[model samples]
Target: MDEGPQFSLEDDGAGGNRLVLSGRYLVSTLGRTNQQLRAIDAPVSAVDLAGVTAIDTVGAWVASTLAQRHGAEITGAKERSLRLLEAVKIRESSGSVAPDRLPVWQRVPDHVGAMMRDLLRGMAGVVGFLGQIILAIGSVIRHPSRFRGRALVRQMELVGVSALPIVGLMSFLIGIVIAQQGAVQLAQFGAETLTVNLVGRITLRELGVLMTAIMVAGRSGSAFAAQIGTMKLTEEVDAMRTIGISPVEALVLPRILASVLMMPLLGAYAAVVAIIGGAVIGEVALGIPFLNFLERIKDVVPIHDLWVGMIKAPVFGLIIGLAGCYQGMQVEGDSEQVGKRTTQAVVSAIFMVIVIDAFFAVFFTEIGWS
Candidate 1:
């Protein structure tokens, strides 16, 4: 039969009191022993558990608490009792309960501070990466033999030639939509003819380059990140370094060069294709001759509009390449990081491209390019 948990106070030879716990010290047997122990006002020098017949976590917690309250040494516990007491002590020390939530005012400022810190760190990383690229460029310039023309051509084909069909198709559809919408809005004013100007100026000055940049960022930027990140994961980059080859020159420069060189040609091609699509819409939907619509584009869309697109194209390309290559180079540890960095590359490139385009718009307007 189990006995109810009980305790007694005894005097030690040192004149301090000892706590002698006895019987089965379990939750069901504890009864009012918890209250009895809490009521004791005398200081305890030692918690003597030698008489404890059996103990559980709850019982251990009670004994642990008693010893802690009086700074008494726990004594004579069997291995199982000792283990239970230790586990309870560890749980208490590590906090078994959830922490209190911070107020909104404190949380908001704390979140903002953390965000700003992360932003600064990211900016520093980008700057350092840019510096490395600049140094690589200098090294390549000094040794022209180090330039990888074949890699540049391959990247050009992958980034530009392979993307042409989709880019053209998208631009064509966008052109038809723009012309149709512009014609509808202008019809109220009996100026449907101005649809030509709308499609021409918008596509050449903004939509052509902007949409192409976004597409390239999603396509080539993600590809760059994934490729380089995979290589990093496999230690191919490290192997290159071991062989005295600069990964930046052998990998990054070629991609960047190809993107920079191809973007203008692609943007111009997309704009022209879009113009053709608008012409088709004119001939089929608006009753204007296709050839007449094409002729009118040249008269209405100024050369400056084309110049704006061409100027933005290579800059957007550079941004995409840098974002992709930098993110890829930063990837470490696992394949999951490759996916994450690839996504970051695409998002960052697209965001930066849009921001730069906005700045370009303002600068061009101020300089009479608009």
Candidate 2:
């Protein structure tokens, strides 16, 4: 039977100590020996390993550490044990465990440069993705048979029809808040009735479409990323390609088309619902007749305001759809990536929507749309 590792120290004839090790020095036998070794701090001039019947890398490391601490020479170690000891020594000398630190000024510039590089790469990727979508749209146009009408209809239901209740509820509450607040502010100026104009114009020109876009980005946009990301993870996208189907046309085009087509309608519906909500507040809180408020919307809110919202709606939808599908297609490696990409899609879509809305606001103001 193999014995557990044991160690002892004895004085050399020259008045120095020699540490002697015995028994099997394998990892399985080193538990008590390790504890015992940690407790010893005696000066030693040499380590003798001849009495060890079996040894491994762990044992070699322990012996090497003990010898180095006391500047002791190792003796009676076989060739295999010597090699392990040398390997551990070399690794300890190499600075692989910790990285070198840079000055704060250097690190700050490096971080900023990296961020800029990432931003440029992301912009290039988005441009390339847009080109792919354009090509896919053209292909569907050239070969009408490739168009998946049922898929488009289904996506439309998911992106638009199914979203109505929540969108309506949200827009209604926003409208009430806007009206109540506007009424109070205008009352200070003795122009309380102008709340009707405030609610109509703002909801039609900005809040209605912007809020709806945000909701859709949170809802359908995230869904698109998750669904396609899951499909990618499952290799379903690859299977479609192997069978001669363009994943872009079969998967992406329908979704984009559905969003582009449905957004104007949804935006218009949300605006109408918001106006109705404002009308409710007007009647109950401001003592304005509901019918008169509705009649006033037609006159107080310009036709151009509705046109501005309608114009932005499809663009917002396109942005949301593109962001979602692009992030989904970018998913790779593991299931964890699907969740991360889904979150990225929602964030990117809403960010781009707000950016584009700002640009449109400036452009329309310059062109006298305001």
Candidate 3:
């Protein structure tokens, strides 16, 4: 039979007190060992483990914890046991073990400061990315031979042609809703005819391009980020670089070009579809004829309203493309990071699109185009 662990305390003339441990220091012996330790009345200055016959991780933890609590020096440990003790000590000192908790008030400032620092760093990175994109575009303009026509066309098909059905359907429903609501309000004032003006101006000057941009940001922008981010994670982007190919030129410019070229056409299509939907609602519900709706739209909506909306489309597309590509480039070697960047790309693109639209609205208003 094996003997359990034991501890004894001795008075050392100059050393305050000494604790001696013997026998198998294992989990089965821990309770007795703890009881023996608790009975000690003297302040422990050192522990001698020379008599310890065998030990394991649980035993080491027990020994280390008692040593820490008593602020006692440990000695006479076997080489392997000493290494384990040292590792536990290192872990405790390094705060890898249980750490002290700070008050919530103290932690709040730390969290806020970290958040602010991250935000500043992110903004700086975006600015740097924008500069890089501009440099890439300038290089492409200087050397048109480097342009990838096939890639651009493929991206256009993905971003534009495939998007038409959803965009048309959403715009049509929105137009019908707007016309119905406007008719209700204008009827109260006996000015139901004004519903056509409301639908035409809102759809042509704002809603059409805004809705199209938002949808594209959610759909194409997230795809761009995920695709490029996966390529980054797989080292395909690095491979392109190694082969003397600019990732910006090969991957980014084609997408950006496709977006800018196709957005205006999509916006115009959305506007026409919405107007037709509104006309249907007006004819059926408000007793307004289709010809009368067309005449009213022509009279109320200026060509400049159409121009304003069209002009915003390319800028919105550019913002969406840049945001997606920038976030993708920022992705590290993590699948989780790819998903995070993809979501961030969509959010950032939509936000920037709205901001740009607001600026355009202000500019047009100041210039008397509104």
Candidate 4:
């Protein structure tokens, strides 16, 4: 049943437009009206939305769009509608955007108050992260048996063994791509022999870790989100709490520990496979001999490059693990929410990896050679 006040319009015409509209919006009502509006082919001026008993975002959108197309004056658009209209008005006034289309600070809320709020939020997050880490460490200490040989073996397999195939494949492809691209540029200078150094250095410090992290984040992040979300939906988290088992300690800690421990090893493996792939390409395509490639690699790849890659590896792993866990925890009992959170986990993990990689690049540049 259509449940609200049915809207009708009254015209008060005296050389001016006066439109009165009243309606109670339901799905069927709005749908039919929206379709009617689309089919309309006449001047619709001075809309009176004041008669709307209860308006929602969709109704507002429809009304606004109608106003735009017909040059009609509309009233009673609310909240989001008001902001959207204001933005549209701004755009309309500036037909061609000026050089300073928006002020520098306008892009993001740059008022002092907003800046202070953002700064406070950032600091709070940092504090919370540190506190969590400390608490985790204390819990580990209380149960030092968790660091047993068997536990280590399990984690090694979980992190290192599982990550191999994907990392190997992606790294090999990346090596080939970098080599091929660099060869095109280097060939002009007749520097075909430099492919080894180019591939080695780039793979070791940048592509190897970055590519591996992205793959793991996509693979593992989704896994964590799905696993945790399903658990949450099934009330497994509540069960764990009832059993006095800290879910964080039981699940998250192991995964984090495993990743942190194995990322360096996986990264090293990626770099090696990538180099082999690049070496194969350089030898066959670039006519550089195997021994010459090895010699070039030895000359250019310092221990520092390997160290940088190894250092970033743990950070990358932590980024993937934390993002997944965070998004998973955000999931409600709703089944759709699980999928949504899983996607967020993968996205946030990848974005964080890229941002961290950029920071590492800057750091490496600043530090220079060992």
Assess the local accuracy of residue 171 in candidate 4 as a C-alpha lDDT between 0 and 100.
87
Assess each prediction's global lDDT (C-alpha) against the native. 0.94, 0.93, 0.89, 0.76
Query: What is the lDDT, from 0 to 100, of the residue 105 in candidate 1?
Result: 100
Q: Write the per-residue lDDT of candidate 4 for residues 121-227, one digit (tens) a residue.
A: 85676467557756866987998864345655675686679879888988888888888889999999998777777899989888888888888888877887788
Ten-residue region with minimum lDDT total, candidate 3:
89-98
Candidate 2 worst ten-residue window by lDDT = 88-97
Error of 1 at 147 (Å): 1.3
Give the candidate order by descending TM-score: 2, 1, 3, 4
Best TM-score goes to which candidate? 2
Would you estimate the TM-scores of all the predictions? 0.77, 0.85, 0.76, 0.65
Candidate 3: segments with Cα more than 4 A from true spot: 1-55, 58-109
Q: What's each prediction's clash count?
A: 0, 0, 0, 3
Give the distance in Å from residue 111's predicted Cα in candidate 4 to where it truly belongs. 16
Which residue pairs show backbone clashes in model 4?
7-22, 7-23, 9-20
Off by over 4 Å in 4: 1-130, 146-155
Which lDDT tens digits does candidate 3 get at residues 50-127? 989888877777788777778888889999788778776634454456677899999999999999999999999989
Q: Model 1: per-residue lDDT, tens digit, 23-75? A: 99988878788999999999899999999999999999999999988989999
Error of 2 at 112 (Å): 4.3
As a TM-score, model 3 comes out at 0.76
